[model samples]
Target: MSPMETGLIGIGALFVLMVLRTPVAFAMLITGYFGMLVLEGSRAAGAVMLTESYSTVSNYNLIVVPMFILLGNIASAAGFSRGLYDAAFAWVGRFRGGLASSSVLGCAIFSAVSGSSVATAITIGKVALPEMKRLGYQDALSTGSIAAGGTLGFLIPPSTGFVLYAILTEQSIGRLFMAGILPGLLLMAAFIGTIALIATINPEAGPRGARVPLGQKFRVLVQSAPLIGIISISIGGIYAGVFTPVEASAIGAGLVLLLAFAMRQLSWNGFCRAILETVRTSAMLYMVVIGANVLNPFLAVTHIPETLGNAMVGLGLGPYGTLAIIILAYVVLGMFLDGLSMLVVTIPIIYPVILQMGFDPIWFGVVAVIVIEMGMITPPVGLNVFVVKGVAQDVPMTTVFKGVMPFLLAMIVSLLLIIIFPQIATLLPDLMFS
Candidate 1:
């Protein structure tokens, strides 16, 4: 059989394994390994597997993954996430739909420290949901805000999604992190606007909470000092050129650890749990990276990217048209695939096409992340929606999904704005590196 045909069949097998509930990393690994054996003999396949496994794990740049994950896990264990929510609530809770807005802001801030969308959603949901509910916020708005807000974790600085994308595409991690900042803040603003619109239309869906006194607001801000300090040190230092991405992550993790201990917020057992969680999460990411690397070689042998890129160029749809198609595919696949899986599996084939089209890699990274954010709130496999549902037991899954619809629109709008103004994603990195 032709290499292209073999590649097609291998793709099918990968999907089949996924549909059978196999983990994404294993599916990619298995498909890539055997496909290579078919295309280049067993020796090449074995060598690729062994080389990717060792190379991926041993790459020093990858240390950022575990360090960032550890920072997040430590922040969660220390209850810093709650402090973030409280501080946001103190500032915005008195306005209409303030609680919901607070949830978005809180998630955005927490996302700076915690890299996982589900973790952001779960942590903020636990803090925001009860307050919104007690203040008579509608279930839809309450659940939807947290669900949508959680997705910010994928685009904000320290995002695991961006890390994986950088690894797959060989982009600069620090630049990707910087590119994410403006887009993240823009999307956060869009979510806040959506909440305002919702509250304006149906006041009962999100009632204003009692205003926080000036003194109390200051007190809440004080409580959030540790979170602010960590974000400033890690993300701030990266932009300031005071630290590399890996160094920033290490510093962030260490500072958070020290803060947690100082505040007595984390028990010794909690610290252990945090460390274990980081290891588990890091191992999973490593496996996926290794699998993607292995799969990339087989895809190269098949010339699938070249085949597809040529076909796309032949169609004369232009770069923008081609990009629109890719984004649409992401929206559709997101309904069934986890965001990370979608990112790793497709980037190897698609990224080359994008670069060939003359798009900025950093800008596209931001755009790709926003598309993944939509998937996190889209129906069927909206991971963040389900995470919020776990926190809001009485709220149906449909309600949470429905609530996120507006924010999803907001996200699309934010994406279009970024597309029109690439600087939104590039300005920070450009300025920083300059």
Candidate 2:
């Protein structure tokens, strides 16, 4: 059979396995190994699988995964999330719809520590949802803001999404981390603006809360200073050339753990729990990366990506037009696949096309993450929406989904602005690294 024919069949088998509820990592592994066997026999396939799996996990750069995950788990266990929310609320909870805005602000701040979107949503949602509800804020606005804000986790520094993208595309993780800073903040602002618009249209949706006194606000900020310091060290340290991504992760994790110990907020059991959770999450990510590595070789042997890229180039559509189609595909796939799955499944195929079009890899990393963030709040499989629903159990799924819609729009606008200017995502990395 032609390589194209074999590649198409392999892809079909992959989707079938996914539909059967097999884990995406295992599905990719099975499809890739079996395809390699068919194309190059058992000996070659076995060697490829073993080599890819070993080399992938053994890579020094990937240590950042566990370190950063540990940092987030430790921070969550130590109750820094509550401090972040309190500080944001003290500063923003007084304006009309300020409670919702505070939720967004808190999520953005917490995202600096926690890289997982669900973690950000759950952390901020636990702290902010009850307060918003107490203030008579509409369920949609309250839930929507948290869900949308949680997505900042995917776009901000310390992002696992960017890590995966960097590894897969062979780009510099530090540059991608820097690139995300501006766009992440821009999207956060868009979400805050979105809440204000919702409040303006219907004042009852978001009533103002009691204003915080200047002294109390300063006190809350002081309480949250450790978190602020951690963010500055981890993200700021990287930008300032003081730490590589790996060093930054290690430093961040150690500091958060020490802070937890100093505050006596985390018991020994809680410390062990954080370590165990970090191991579990890191192992899962490693397995997925191994699967992607194995599958990438198989796809290369099939010449699938080249064929796809050449086919795309032949269509005569300019780069932007082709980009639109790719983004649209992500939108459709987001309805079914989680963000990481979408990245592992598509990046090998799409990234070659992107590079061929003369786009900067670092910039595309930001663009791709923003699109995935949109997916986290989109319908049918909006992971963050469901996460917020889990927190706000009394809020209907429909209301949560409705609330997320405006934030989703804000994300789209943010995406467009980044596209039109490009520098919003690239300038920081260029200035810092170049």
> Can you write out model 2's per-residue Cα lDDT over 402-424, one digit (the tens) per residue?
98998888888999999999999
TM-score of each: 0.99, 0.99
Clashing pairs in 1: none
Q: What would the per-residue lDDT of candidate 1 be over residues 1-434, giving only the tens digit for each residue?
A: 99999999999999999999999999999999999999999999999999999999999889999999999999998888888999998999899999999999999999999888988999999998998989899999999999999999999989999999999988899999999999999999999999999999999999998889999999999999867988998999999999999999999999999888988899999999999999999999999999899999999999999999999888899999999989999999999998999999999989989988999999999998899889998989899988999999999888888888888889999999999999999999999988
Local distance difference test values of all predictions, in order: 0.93, 0.92
Error of 1 at 54 (Å): 0.5
Pick out the ten consecutive residues of candidate 1 with the lowest summed lDDT.
Answer: 224-233
Candidate 1 TM-score, C-alpha based: 0.99
Backbone clash numbers for all candidates listed? 0, 0
